[model samples]
Target: MIVFFLAIAILITIKIIWVLCATSGQGSFDREKKEIIRRANYLTSMVCTSPQGLLDEMPSGIGEQFQGEWALYTCSMTSAALANIAILYPPNKELSIKFIDQIIDIAMSEEIREYDKLRWREDPMDGIYGNLSHISYYSHLAWMISRYKQIGGDGKYDDLYHSLCKAMNRRIRKSKSLNLPTYPGEYIYIPDMLVAIVALANYSSQYEGKYSTTVDMWVERAKKEWIDKETGLVASFLEAYNDSVQIVLPVKGSYSALNCYYLSLVDSEFAKEQYDCLMKNYKQGFPFAGLKEYHDRTCLFGMDIDAGPIIFNLSPSGTAFTIGCAASLDDMEFRNKLLKTAEIGGSTVTWFGKSHYLLANLALVGEAIVLAMRTSAPQTRMRNK
Candidate 1:
C-alpha cells in the first residue's frame, strides 16, 4: 500500500522502502513476480520521464524557496533504483543505461546547476557544506554515486562522490548517533542516516578500513533510537534515548517498514529480527493479511504524512514496501500474497500513457522499491575492478 501522495505528502523518502502478515495466495508465483516487475518497470520509467522543469521549492530560513527535500529525495530514489536495476534486474540492462542517462541529466542539467548557483539553499559562508541542507541533501548523492559506479559509471562522478562523503563524514563524526542533522536538531529521518551509512560502506570498500567500523558503530547506536521497547518493532521517530511511549512515537508501518528496507541492507540480521517483530505487531489480517500504518494505540488517529489513508488500518505504503523486505528475507509466500493484494486493490494505474498507483500516483519511490526487492541481497554491491 505504499500510496505516495505526490505534491501533498511525500510518498516515500525511499533511498524506495517494509510489512504484511497475510499468507493468502490468489495468483500463481510466476504471475505475481511478472506483475511486480511490470509495475516496477512502469514506475521507474515514469521517474525517468518526470519533468525537471520547475524546481519544487519551499520556504527556507526567511524568504528562500529551495529548501525542500523533494528534489534531493528524487535524486536518491532514482539512483537507488539504478542500483537495483544494475544488480538485481539484469534483463533490463539496456534499458537501465538509458535511465542512468536521464538521472545524470537531472543532476547536471543547466536548470539544476543554475538553481544550485543562485537559489540552492546553503550557508552564508562559502564553505561547501556550511549549510546543513547542503550536507543533508548530498549524503544520498554519495550513496547514489557509489551505486552508480558499480555499474561502470564513468569516473566523472568520482569527485562528486568524494565531496559528498567528505561533508557527510564530518557530520557522522559530530552527531552522537551518527544521525546527520537534517534540520540541526534531534529530529532526524532514519532513511537519510541509513543512506549515509551505505555511502560510508561504499567509501570503505575503496579505502579498505576507514569507514567500515564507523558504520558498525553507528548501527549499534541507531538500534536504540529506532526500535520500540514494548513491541520491539521499529518506531516512526525517536525523541531521545528514553523508551517512554511518549518519547518513542508509535510504530507506523510506513517509517518502520522503510527503516527495515535500508536497515536490511545495513544490518540484515537485525533487520530480519525487526521485520519478524513488525510482522507480529503491525501486520494485521483483514480476513487476509495486510499491514496497518499504526499500532493499536495510534490506529484511531488520522493518517500522517508518511502513512497515507488507512483503510481498515491497512497502510498501502507499509504493505507495499514490505514486499521488498519479504523479498529480502526470501519470504516468497508473503511476498506473493502482498503482490496479489496490491494488484487486486487497484493501486497500479495507467495515466497519460504512464503506469503508476492511483492512491498516490507519485509512487516513484515506492515503485522503485518494488524493483529493489527483486534482489536476494538488497545491500550495495561493491565492484573492485
Candidate 2:
C-alpha cells in the first residue's frame, strides 16, 4: 500500500512540474507551432508599429554596456525577422513597408539616428560602418531592403539599397583581416565572419560577380587555422589576420548551432560539414526533446555575452536559434524537436491580440529565429504575386 501510494504521489508531482514548465494550449510542446507563429508576430509587431522604436525601449535587464550597443545587434535580428515576414507570410503591406523603410533609414546613415530618449552606442566608428566594415552594419539592412523591395514592387529604396551595398564592398576592399576585428582592436568573432560572408554573397548575386572566390579563401583559411586539431570545429575567437585560435569554443552547442546556420547561407558544403561535426559531438538527447548546446567539461568555462544562462551548458538562446537553422537546412525533425524544447522552456502569454513570451522569455533573437523557422519552410513563404 505504501508503494502504491508513493507511485501516485510521484506521478502527481511529475504532472505538476510539467504544467509549470510547459507552455499553454494543453500546455504541450509539439503542437505549439501556431503559438510560435503568434509569438514571432508579437516580436515583429514591436518593430512594425514603430520601426526604429525598439531603440526607445532599451535598458531592459541586460548590462548597460550591452544595452548601449543594442541597436547594432538588434538591427540584424530585426531585418532577418521582418524581411521573412513581409516576403513569406500574408502581406501586411502597411506594417512590413514601414518596418523595411525604417531599416533603410538606419542603413543609409553614418550612424543610426538619435531617437528622443535612446542610448545608442556612440563610438567613433558608430557611423554606417559600425564596429568594423566587414562586419558591416549596413549589409543586413541592405539585404532586408533588397528582399522586401523585390517582394513589394517599390523602387523607392533602390538607391539606398545600392549605396549600402557599396558601403559594404568599400569596407571589404579596404579591410586587412579580409574580415575586420569585431571590436575595433579586439579579436574577430566567427559568427560575424559568417554574416559578412552572407552579406557579400547576397550583394554579388544581385549584381553578378564571382564573390565566391573570396568566400572560398575565407573558408579555406578558417579550416586551415581557426579549426582546432583535436575537434574539427572552429574556435570562437580567432586572430583577424592569421586566423589563429584565440579562444577555443570547443563544441559548445549554442554557438556551433548558430555558426552552423549562418555559415550555411554562404557555403552550404562547408557549413554542412560543421553541422555534421556539431551533431555528432554536441547534440544532447533529453526525455522530452534535444538541446544543441555544449555537454562537455568546456561547459564549466563561464558563458559569453550571447550565451544566456548556461545551465548544464545548454543555453536557452542557442538552442532556440538552432530551430531556424534546422528549418533553413530542411532538417524538420531537429527543428521540431528544438521547438518542443522552446515550448517547454517558454510559456504563453497574450496581450493586445498577440502572443508574448513570458516566464523564461526567449528575447528578441530567439523570437526572430522562431519567425525564420516558420517562414523558411516553403509552405509559409509568400506566393509570388
Candidate 3:
C-alpha cells in the first residue's frame, strides 16, 4: 500500500516537471503552428503515400466497425490542422493548400469511403446526391472543403461543395427533428450533426442565408430538447426512431467539447454557454488537469472507445478536445494547462524535423486530433448576436 501511494506521488511529480520544462512553449501561436506544421508534414506524407498503411497503425481497440470511419476522421483532422495553420500563419498558406488538396484526393477516394458505403449500402457521394444519409462521412468532407476555401484555395471543389450544401440543407428540412444520423440507423449523435450544421452555417454566411433557416431551427430545437436541463451540456446522442427523439447519453464531455468546438465556428455566444457548462461540470484535477468523460464525477465509468482511457477521472478524448474548445473560446489559461497535460501524458517527441506524440503515434487519429485542437482559433460568428 505504501509503495503504491509512493509510486502515484512520483508519477505526479514527474508529470509536473514535464509540463513546466518540456512543453513550456506550448499554446503560443508560433509554437503551436510550428508543431502542427511538423505533424502535418508527417501525416500528409503518410496519408498521401499510403492511407491504407496508415490505417494499419490504428488502435484496434476502437473496433473494426469504426476502423474506416476513423481513417476518414484522421485525414479530416489532419486537413483541419493544416487549414487552421494556413489561416493563422499566412506564410504557410500555399503549402497548406497543396497539402489539403492531396489529402482531399485521398479522403474522397472510394477506399476511404468504404466504411460508410458498407454501413449505408451506397457510396457516400451518391448518398449525398440521393438522401445525405451518411452524415459522418459527408459532413466531414464538407467541413474539409469549407476549410480549404477559407485557407485561400481556389474554388477547385466548388461543384462538390455546392452539392453537399444542397443535400445537407434538404436533409435537415426533411428530418422531423431537423437533425440527421451518423449512420443509416436511428442513432443521431448530436456532435456529428453539429459539424454538418456548422458547415451549412458557413455556406449560408457566404451565400446570402441559403440555409440560415435550417441552421436556426436546428439551434432552437437543440437548445430546447438536446441540452441537459440540469447539466446544461449538450446530450451526446439521440434516438430519432419513429419520428420521436430521445436522449441516449446525457452530457458527456467527449462529445460536448467537440460540439462546442464546432459550434464556436458559427455560434460563439451559444458555444460560450455550453463551453462554460462543460468546464464547470466536467473539468477535473489540478496542476495535471483534464475533463472527465462522464457528468457524474463520482461514478467509475472506466473506459470507452470515444472517451478513450479514463484515469483518475480525466478522459483522454474529453481532455484533448477541450483544448479545442478552450482555444476557440480564448480561454488561454485552460488551453495552456491542458496543453501541458497533453505533453506530459502524450510523451511528445520531435525527430527528423517532424513532431508527434510518441504515445499517440501508436494511433494516428489521436495525433491528428491533437494537432487540430491545438491549432484551432476563434472564428467570427455567423449569426447576429
Each model's C-alpha lDDT? Answer: 0.59, 0.58, 0.80
Stretches of candidate 1 exceeding 4 Å from the true structure: 1-41, 49-68, 107-135, 224-226, 240-247, 298-301, 347-355, 359-364, 374-385
Residue 365, candidate 3: how far off, in angstroms?
1.0
For 242-294, candidate 2 gives per-residue lDDT tens digits of 53235545545666677777776666677778777776776766544545456
RMSD values, in order shown: 8.6, 5.5, 3.1
**C-alpha lDDT of residue 342 in model 2:** 61
The number of residue pairs in model 3 that clash at the backbone is 0
Please give each candidate's TM-score.
0.74, 0.75, 0.91
Residues 1-385 of candidate 3 have per-residue lDDT tens digits of 9999999999989877765766766757866566677777777766665656656667776665588878888888888888887777778899999988888877888777888888888888777779747888878888888888877788899999999888888888888988788876557888899888988887886678888888888888888888777788778889876787888866688988898888888778999998989978888876368888776755444867788877777888889999999888888788988888888778766778777777766677888888798777766421110
Better of 1 and 3 by lDDT: 3
Could you say which candidate leads in TM-score?
Answer: 3
The best-first sequence of candidates by lDDT reads: 3, 1, 2
Backbone Cα, N, C clashes tallied per candidate: 9, 4, 0
Candidate 1 minimal-lDDT segment of 10 residues = 14-23
Q: Which ten residues in a row have the lowest lDDT in candidate 2?
A: 111-120
